[model samples]
Target: MAACAPDPEPRERGSRSPSASGRTARPGEGLLAQWDADLLEAAGAGDAASVTALLDRGARIEARNEDGRGPLMLAALADRVEAATVLVERGADPDATDDLGDTPWVTCGVTGSVAMMRVIWEAGPDLTVPNRRGGSPLHPASERGHADYVREVLATTGIESVIDRVNYNGWTALLEAVALGDGGEPHQEITAMLLDVGADASLRDRNGRTALDHARARGYGVIEDLLA
Candidate 1:
């Protein structure tokens, strides 16, 4: 299994650097750091009571740990729908991105969590938020064959129109789907849906081959015919 990458930056919301402690150490400094630690743990564990208690005690709701992961991000990663919902309702920014520029919506899309994604979307995440690679959450879902999640995102009136959106490599969601799909009935179905919805089947990637060319190279006869 691939190791889970750590968050690049850990924001110390209430922790004082050791340098500052040399001149004068405050009695409550230790207590404050401990409280922050508790808040992070509670958010990860999905303990609603603990979350509320910590926040009420002045914990930074958006505090990021060493990985730049906020409490809401942790909850979403854990698939705690209720906890995620609660955090968003408590004013967590749904559009908060990690150091890698992956937002809550992008995480949900990558994890294939339709329910969690809906929660984030309803909380007002911009579906068009692109990552460092210029790919939005929709690209991952469509590429990974998360059909239900893809449908959910695509059904959003304006979002569906991005089916032909190309990334830095000039590969659209349709290109990704064709490249990664198994070429079965489902793959052909998705490909057809993409094309019918205005995906530019003829659009080539950096390699100068259209999505159908890739399908043909991979022996996806049905998908190739459908695109053709």
Candidate 2:
């Protein structure tokens, strides 16, 4: 499963605090401020050329906006795969978490950007790192039923241990999948896949609710049968 966090849209360039052009500027208001502003603009627009230009001019590759989103995260959220790639190549922190504790990979998964997800995942993020709620990327993937992403993570990375990891609520991937109610065939299949992959079906959450109990209470007979 793809565990991603909710990504908010970035602010437009023009809306940013501007610096006065040419001299006449105060210590805090000079070329540096404008450069910072431009870096954010390049990130928001996914203009790789512009970003490269700024970076060549000594722009910090890891510049954060007022909202605390790094260039890489902004690019990923915009589905700008190329720009994201460029940023990553330029030393952008793939594991940089926003104020909300979401990394670029998590944002990609939550936004259902399969292509972006692939890019970030390939860049080598520690997928086991939990979000603010203590659920890893696998938790969101299973919850949202992103089967392909889920399968890719499992196949391409060492995600088996992550699958059975419990969250703040002590819910594992299987438990979240069961509680997510039938997101469709993908969800059902993912739930089944988790079990088949040796997810601990007998494990219970903080409330003492096991995946088996969740499936049974929700009338998910297929999942219940799988657990049994």
Candidate 3:
């Protein structure tokens, strides 16, 4: 559930608009801009050395791209574990959200990278933060049938409260799992994990359909039994 915002208009390298002082550039502004750009590039490329170099050169670790995604977010989105580690170790905020309110931790759920998840988690992200859809990372992980990611999220402290949190569409993690799942082993395992952690089977969606109804309608007998 990444945020969807129009990208900011592109700017030239080291370019700056005229300020109130009629100055097109300030002291060290060009250097900082270039460092930020390099940091983004290094992060996206998973070049830990370049990332560290940029950080050491006073690049703002939280500097965002046009989409409001910072270095850690880009690294997580790209599954660049090494770059993510470098950013986190250099004091990047793992909980930094993009324009869509999607944090690096939440992005890890989408990538289904346990290593990224662990790296971001160890950096102390706020697991309670919801994405733009008003769902926690567990929501996307569950919807995508990412059993391992779902388990890791549930294992996080205070994440149990997020399991039953409904999204903008009124589908909780369990409901999404049941609705979007293929009734495969992964889905079944996810369902079991949610249930074992006390996810309410009786929760309904915006259409007033419960997880059991979805399972039954989809003819997911195994899931139906679990919901029952």
Q: Judged by TM-score, which candidate is best?
A: 3
What would the C-alpha RMSD of candidate 3 be, to one decimal place? 11.9
Judging by TM-score, tell me the better candidate of 1 and 3: 3
**Best-to-worst TM-score order:** 3, 2, 1
Model 1, global lDDT: 0.76
- Candidate 3 has an lDDT of 0.86
Per-candidate RMSD vs. true structure?
12.1, 13.4, 11.9
The C-alpha TM-scores of every prediction are 0.79, 0.80, 0.86
- By lDDT, highest first, what's the ranking? 3, 2, 1
Expressed as tens digits, the lDDT of each residue in 94-198 for candidate 3 is: 888899888898887787788898899888877678887888888888888889887776776468876788888889989988898788999999999999999
Candidate 2 residue lDDT tens string, 1-228 = 998987977744433234466443222335556676788788778898988887876667777888788888888878888788788778787789888888887776566667777777767887667765788777877888888877776666677877777878778878888887584678788887787678888888888988888888888887777778
Residue 65 in model 2: lDDT? 83
Give model 1's TM-score versus the native structure.
Answer: 0.79
Worst 10 residues of 3 by lDDT: 11-20
